[model samples]
Target: MAGLKKKMTIPFARVPVAINEQKYVQEVLESGWLTTASKAAALEKKFARVVQAKYACAVNSGTAALHLGLEALGVKPGDRVFVPSMTFTASAEIIRYLQADPVFLDTEYGTNLITPGILEEAIALHPDVRFLIVVHYGGQAAPMVSDENQAGILEICNKYGIKVLEDAAHAFPARLGERMVGSLGDVTCFSFYANKPLTTGEGGMLTTRNKEIYDRVKKMRLHGIDHDVWDRFTENKPSWEYDVVEAGYKYNMPDVNAAIGLAQLEMAAEFRAERQRAAMFYYEHLGQLQEFMDLPVTRVPFSDHAWHLFPVVLKEKAPLGRNEFIKKMAMAGIGTSVHYKPLHRMTYYKNRYHLDAKSFPRAEKTWQGNVSLPIFPYMTPEELNYICKTIEKLLKY
Candidate 1:
């Protein structure tokens, strides 16, 4: 302890500012059309093209995108939505918003995603379930393209008339062959939160191949307006009059946010590569600690990971518990986080649905020891080395 140097603090996550972010923001400021105008429409088109979707609707938040996706699928009260327990609250909360029930499923230990077996069981248990919110957990995709009799997960869902709504919040540029996550699902939602692969401070996009679903999401995203204000203002024959098609929420992304997203989109590929590099650094260094922890898996067949968050699971034989390990890391100026607590363990969901921790064995087991290390596009090589060394030292001690 006598010769120990002070350790500089490392943050768990950081947003990478695109080269043109400031320029785009400044342009939006000068244009004077801030609320879901030309910028939003342009972003939508570009984003849709990037994800290989027919349409994309920009919204205020990822939660809003999920909510509208449910609306687009016509989820009604008492309808049951099959969801994995190992996800963020938004994935389940949106089901409640529609007055629907969420039938939670267990996660697969290896992938930390819902598998075909889980799907089959859930379907048998709740035959009337109409929707499935498959989250691309940690940017590693769910079994969208599986080798099952019904084809893949998407096809399986189709067999049951269950609409597959992808919660692609962590997966922006993730792909399975030529088809992207957004294009595979009936509707897909993406987040542009500060810590996401792409950032707009706070924004999201809802994409779909169905024209009807696309049109409905577009209208519902903006107070059910028959047409967006951008159309009227930019047209040669401009008129202020508009009709409200239905009661809808006020969930439109402003131009300021869209401008940032546009700039971020331009550098999406670069951002993904940088994140992947950082993840590889973690994998290479941390694999040595396999006796104590399960390092994040990089190679999953038929898929390309977005490398959103590098999560490692501490084995049962670990010397210290997850929280204690985190405390030690914190003291050493190394930041760490848990990807999620199983949603069923949350008080509200447990009380509402009568869930027991014993039921979701895989989710609970994974949640107990999971830790997400600092991973971002901007992480320097020195930072990566420091984190790796710190973890190795802690494990040895």
Candidate 2:
């Protein structure tokens, strides 16, 4: 052990900071108004403008945003909703929150996305399904509108009168064609968790063009209060006269988190560029290893993808299985994660719904090999080299 070299550590994610992060956060602390206030309100306005949506409501988490979005869409008990089995649990669990049943559908193989074709098939099977939650998987925006010759998800949903709620947890600042993901669907929810493209410590935003839906979410996000606490306190009339219009959850984003979000929002484009740079580096170095592993696929330009995660799929011909590959990467001081194990494979969904793994062929197959690599803003060239080289050394056998 005399001259053994120390291994270099590369984390699965590193939160990138903007110039104003601390400055804005300090101002919020000094103001003594930390709960949902002016800061949160300002964030909503700026976020709406950035995503090109008519209205935005900041909430405590992406899951809260999803719940509110679905509630605003009028999802009720006994309603059947279409959701992809490939995404995070929140996409499907929120349906259960409303006492609705989730009819999980399979995603496309390479992209791990619910395509228009998949939607059509699911709709035919469940003719009464009137709601859909489409996830923009791993920063790549799913096509919500039709392109030249192909019908998009929105078009297919429209044909069946299904309401679409976009779960854009990994897709802040992502686009389809010229439009941002938040503005593409009936309602879109974005996350600002510490590791998301934009970090707010813990927060989310719901965006929509519909005034009715916007108004409903706003009122319902905070115990169904007719007026916001900030509005009541700042206005001359009275601070404690607001009425609870209906039962709602306590899911308001604090001013402290909003302060961080405001700063992060200002630097979103720069953060996205750095993440894309890291993604491109992986593609350049790992392109040759496709015979053993499959790189992420996207229909849009690389710049249009937010690159929140750089996930690879190991093939049967790989030198090792997914778990062994991840273990080897960790041993080499590189952190990695499995994007998902698939909802159909989870005990709760599997047992409760009697889900068969065979039903979600694409998701099950993808899950078997899916491993999310280290991709983050400001990843150094040396660090990138180490990661890719480590992967090649492990898989080239």
Candidate 3:
């Protein structure tokens, strides 16, 4: 490998930025209100308008958003939700938080979605599935829960009073037919981590159409207080009088983060377009390799794809195993990772759910062979060259 040219690096993600993001964050810092977290409310409003979510509430993280979505949907203990086995741990962990059980359903062979057929089969076996938690893996829209596929999955859920909670950490502005991802389901959530399409450094938002759910989420987000806050030490506010109606968690976003998000939201279209451009470049250059790896969906062939992850599943006969390939890339200074390792593989869930990898074959396939490549909105051309060179070296033409 000595004569080989030194390869430039490709980062897995390059956070998008707007011209005004820095200025806005500085303004928030100068304002001196660092912690009360009102920017979360403003960001909520911005989120509602941007994604067309009827209501939006900010939280500390994506995991917190999932938990709040669960609580807002009234998912109580003993409830059983159907979740695809191929997803981030938060998708199932939130269910566990409520003392609820999550039944794992494998994803479709060619798609990241949990097809209605699998869901229908699983539902038929366990008539008690109280919640349908569909995960939209890698920023693509979740499979449409239309009545056509499972005959009456939603209708049956309605009859049984089951709820729908979508885990859309990767999906930002993901579209389902005519509606946005946040608008497609009963409750939707999005992350604004550094790697997400929108970045608030570390923040998330929970959204819904139900006003009642919004009301509860709003009050619960900042502790069950009925008033504004204790910081206003000015004249109009009372000296010391507050009402603690019920218990709540301190999962609100700070103004600094919201300022970043507020500015980032305005640049969403540009960010999305850049992401699309990068996806096109990768596809045009690498798509012929379908003989080597399963390429990402060109369009979902039905609706738009947000392209949050450029995940390529290795063919069984590929030159290297997924782990081996990742090792090679990392050593070459190209970062890579499996989107997930089957939540069943985690010690916590494995012990808690008594999950055996052998029981779910498809999930194991993902665990064994799926690898995500760096597809960022801002990957430099030189960096792209190195990423491509590294892959070309590892694969059989």
Q: Each model's C-alpha lDDT? A: 0.86, 0.91, 0.76
* 294-375 per-residue lDDT for model 1 (tens digits): 8765435323788888888988888888998898888878888988888898999999899999988988888889998998
Of 1 and 3, the candidate ranking higher by lDDT: 1
**Residue 309 lDDT in candidate 2:** 87
Supply the global lDDT for candidate 2. Answer: 0.91
lDDT string, candidate 2, 111-193, tens digits: 98888888888888889999999999999998788988789999988988999999999998998888998899779999888
- Quick one: RMSD of model 2? 1.9
Model 2: CA > 4 A from native: 1-6
lDDT per residue for candidate 3 within 42-127, as digits (tens), equals 77887888777898878888888888888888888898888887888889988988898988887765556776567767877889
Better of 2 and 3 by lDDT: 2
Name the runs in model 3 displaced over 4 angstroms.
Answer: 1-5, 36-38, 145-156, 228-239, 298-303
Candidate 1 lDDT = 0.86
- Cα deviation in Å at residue 54, candidate 2? 0.4
Ranking by lDDT: 2, 1, 3
